[model samples]
Target: MNKSTYITAENPMSATFRYLAISIMFMFVGFLFGKLFVPASLVYAANIFVVILIVGLLIFSLMSRKNVIPTSFSMNFVYLFTFVDGILMYPILTYYLYDLGTSLFINIVLSTCVIFAVFAFISHKKPAGYFIGLGNILLTSLMVLLAMTIVNIFFNAPVFNILVSAFGIILFSAYILYDVSTLKHYIESGRITCKNDLSIHVLNLYLDFVNILLDLLRIVSDLKD
Candidate 1:
């Protein structure tokens, strides 16, 4: 396979890389559009609708006969989902920009990339299924985190807030490892040979990366304040 080409089943690793790259690219596109092209209100206004669209598309993609991926719809919807997520992040990022300026944003970006790389490296070096067994625990952790977030809206305790952010970092870091380990399983087992499978994996890692960055940003800002 050429260094630069669409990933086919023949080269699953390359395909995975390509899909991840596309995921990151779409995220950047959405963030840039949100930052430069329009106000956050527009995206905020479309938030509910976009969420519906994202969910609908996800269901449709999964159910469609074309779900094997390499199908246009699968690829397109993957991009669309990430793009929308980036747009949704606009307000939060914008606020950070205003409060902490560009330096924090840049540092967070670098931190995310480095953290992902380190975790990915570790995942690759480890045996397959290393983190796969943690799937249930990971899900439970997220649910617990979500519940805490909602509760914090009312309590607003400083100690609790810091703990939440710290937990966010740990959870997402584990997630990156989990996702990568799962990707290895998928490729080796020939379970997710198509683009759809790759896209789903990419989405998982992309989300993990995004959350980790957000958590890191929050931690840094908290320290500064």
Candidate 2:
């Protein structure tokens, strides 16, 4: 299929959102499959698989960004990756669902949606360049956060974990604003001229939403403890 078959300059935003919706749907399907069919005994193995998949996807995304990979292929990869990711989320989701109960789980999801929507709206109103400039600062913060996470693994301190989770919430919240603005800039500047480019934006938004949900979940769990 032609690269531009689904996307057009006039309505790139709509096309991107459509792709995002589809990706999220695939993730939900994967989550259900994992929750229902997968044995709890395999959760550890699933975590290993997910870690490897994440690394692979990161490499693939880098290649796609450099235009070394075909856009069509990259788009398909995004969907598959998202599905696997959702399946892997089974363990964490169940923990939260069971521990917090159905109502609280729903509330957490609603809160995530609200946070995502607010940042997206803010991005829409701001000039893309403003958020684009934040790219470096966010990346630096992310690296520092990763280092802290690694250190916490050894110490396993509750206070440290809480601090990291709090930092993560702030970092990823900024990321949502940056990513949404970047997507808007890409569409407006004609950088996203094909359907394939939409995959990256879909993945970015998905990660942003998921990360924020996770950080919120951790915080809530800590509070409960």
Candidate 3:
């Protein structure tokens, strides 16, 4: 099919790019703040920052009638939500599950398998349908991860924390690839149409980078322990 077939009234690529740049700037600022202060405190602070970011984006979406935001922008936004859900929620939840020891790794493997399996099942669908489906899956997965994390806080343990972190690295890495591919397809196929779409693009990109940071933090934290 021709690329123009997917073009909507909204063009999100430009806006998505701008959002991605802004997010990167925030990351640097957050990083520097962490170095100057307590590392753990910085993480917690970032958690709050991410939550605020989500609210801001949602408001932006609600304000704009057209969802023509760039794929990159939406991708970053998705990435950010993943970070808030994963980093802010998972470790604490797994703290209790840590008592489950290496068993928690099973959770990681299972979740990863399920996510990829779902992706594979629908990858061949129409681009719009495929993305919408994928987004729903990721969102659902985050919900599960969040629940587990909340539970972990009260039941804090060390071993489970390690497992969760390791798994997060792998899972988020896979998502980075998945998200990048989706963005490329959307842009190349002319699937993006409006400001809302652009927001989605930025959201995904933010999610990818933020998740990577979270994974890295877990890796480092575990090693230090």
Clashes of each: 0, 0, 54
Work out candidate 2's RMSD over C-alphas: 3.7
TM-score of 1: 0.78
Could you say which candidate leads in lDDT?
2
Better of 1 and 3 by lDDT: 1
lDDT of 3 by residue, 143-213 (tens): 44544444445565667655655555555554544554566577666666544455564555555455445
Candidate 1: how large is its RMSD? Answer: 6.0
Candidate 1 per-residue C-alpha lDDT over 98-153 given as tens digits, one digit per residue, 9 for 90 to 100: 66779867888888899998998899788877889988787777767666655655
Per-residue error for 1 in candidate 2, Å, reads 6.6
- For residues 1-225, could you state the per-residue lDDT of candidate 2 as single tens digits? 555653543477777667777887888888998989889876645423433433343344334334575544466777897798788788767767776789998899989889888988888899875688888787777767766766765675778878887887788788888878888888777677676777777777777777777767767877787
The order by descending lDDT is 2, 1, 3
Clashes of 3: 54
Runs off by more than 4 Å, candidate 2: 1-10, 42-73
What residue runs in model 3 are displaced by over 4 Å at the alpha carbon? 1-19, 30-140, 194-196
The C-alpha RMSD of each candidate to the native structure, in angstroms, is 6.0, 3.7, 10.2
User: lDDT scores for all predictions?
Assistant: 0.68, 0.72, 0.47
Q: Candidates 2 and 3: which is better by lDDT?
A: 2
For candidate 1, give the lDDT: 0.68
Candidate 3 overall lDDT versus native: 0.47
